[model samples]
Target: MFSRAFSNPYISKWIVQGAGIIWFLGTFGLLMYYGVGQAVAIVDALIFALFFIFGVNIIDQTFNFYVPSGRNNSMLLIFPLLFSLVASYFHFQLLRWIFDEESLYLVFLREVFLLRWAVLGMAEILVALLALAVSKLEEQKEIKNREVMMHELSREAELSQLRQQLQPHFLFNSLNSISALTISQPQKAREMVLQLSDFLRGTMEKDHQQWVSLEEELTYLKMYLDIEHVRFGHRLEVVFDVTDEVKQLRLPQLLIQPLLENAIKHGLYGITEDVRIILRAYKEQNYLMVQIENPFDPEVAAPKGTGFGLSSVGRRLFLLFGRKDLLESKAVESVFTVILKIPQHK
Candidate 1:
């Protein structure tokens, strides 16, 4: 059980105002009916309104202390009744003091208990019940909010795990390329290591970022391409056709890297005279469009990776935007194309 004079500010204000009106009307009506002078009746009404409001607040707090929600003890009912009786006795004495008339004490005390205290006690009980309802609702809201926050944290943890997996997978592939080059061309192998260092440094700087500008992402991609460029030499070629308008538009960091890596793995991995990887970016009305196209031998199966290539891209885009249809892939003739329709974030 808790004692409170109010549940909410608006409700408390209106309750006090309404109770004051009722007290003044009742006091003035009774005094006027008993042939009291109008001046004394008005004075009595003002004093009665003040005392009644104060006494009602005490009754409300008393009932709240006894009649709390979600509990039903017989003792709870007895406490409020006893407290109301005591409060009524004090209110009667206060009125007798204000009126300065000892003869009126018995009649006033009788009226206080039988009429005023009965009505106000019931009103106080209702107020306590209303407070209980409000408290229950607030508690429920807090619980729901906490659950949502925990769910979001869990989701972020899962995404972080997936993101963490990408770095090791990429590092392993890069180290293998460096190993293969070290046996044949030690100079190129050392150059690839330097490029890898720069690339990893850039990646480390943006490790905490979920999104970056298209230009910034492209800068990181080029750092990656520098290493692949040394590995492939003239055998691998890339053509970038991006619009100036979409250059500064924000995109998920490392979103297109896996797709580009998959393209390189599929196209120029084995037998290649010359392979061209076409990369394009532009704005299509409200969405930013990115496309990657590469040639693959239809006779041979696509290179198997650690299952974090195109699927990872699709999953990440879905997680970020809540749209499953944003990443589209198609194989037409000898060319495989992946199209990304990213919603522009303002």
Candidate 2:
């Protein structure tokens, strides 16, 4: 109780101010009404202030213990009032010990102790209730803040699952390639099936994560490319030029794969000659830049894709980063290039 009363700045400040007021009143009243000497009156006031302050501090601690239990509200009031009355009686006895009991008999009989106890008790209860109300409001605000945070997390998870959905045509094409390879190249067909299985497993694992290290994402992409490489054979070639520093950086799961799929679909659908797909990842200034370029003959290849892959990637990037300029694409002659800039977080 003593520790809590002294540690609380609000309670401590009021107690100090109350003690000063008590000292001033006691010194002035004794000098005016009882014709006491200045030294004696001041000494008496000092002792009275110290003891009164101690009693008020103890009352504040007592109320603090009872305010939390709703069933103890009545007890909270009764206990402090009784304490004040007992303290007032003690103060009356102390004053008699300090001064002449015969001289101050009339003053003690005027019932000043009862009035002082009543006012002090009421003030103590009011301060305690106000502090309790403030504490309750703070707790309510924290609970509301936690609810808002949880709602946002659930929304993000739903959007992530949507973005991870596999395109139907991609699955159909892979299956057809596997069936054709099974006849003449059973070994390659078996290898492609294993690669496909690993790729899908990695995708499922990454779907549950918001972000993954660049190295892990690239490993999953490599498994996917192995399947596509077996389908196209020598006609498709992929080159990755990633910096060592960029490998540890992270980006949203499955973020880069859609861009590569679009490149392969638009760049090598009907072409016959060998074509190289180039991927470059590096840290540029404050952004992690990834660029993909592939060669496509406009005359031989079918019309460019419906833009769904790139559009979906862009939408997901905007949702994650809240920026439109992060994903960009441009085609110059026979070569199509796509660039993604992910902000580097400290």
Q: Who wins the TM-score comparison?
A: 1
Task: Give the residue spans of candidate 2 off by over 4 A.
Answer: 1-110, 114-122, 159-173, 179-188, 201-212, 270-275, 295-324, 331-335
lDDT of 2 by residue, 10-49 (tens): 7767756775686568655865576656665666566556
Encode model 1's per-residue lDDT on 79-111: one tens digit a residue: 446555566667666666766653554464455
Per-candidate TM equals 0.83, 0.63
Backbone N/Cα/C clashes per model: 0, 0
**Pairs clashing in candidate 2?**
none
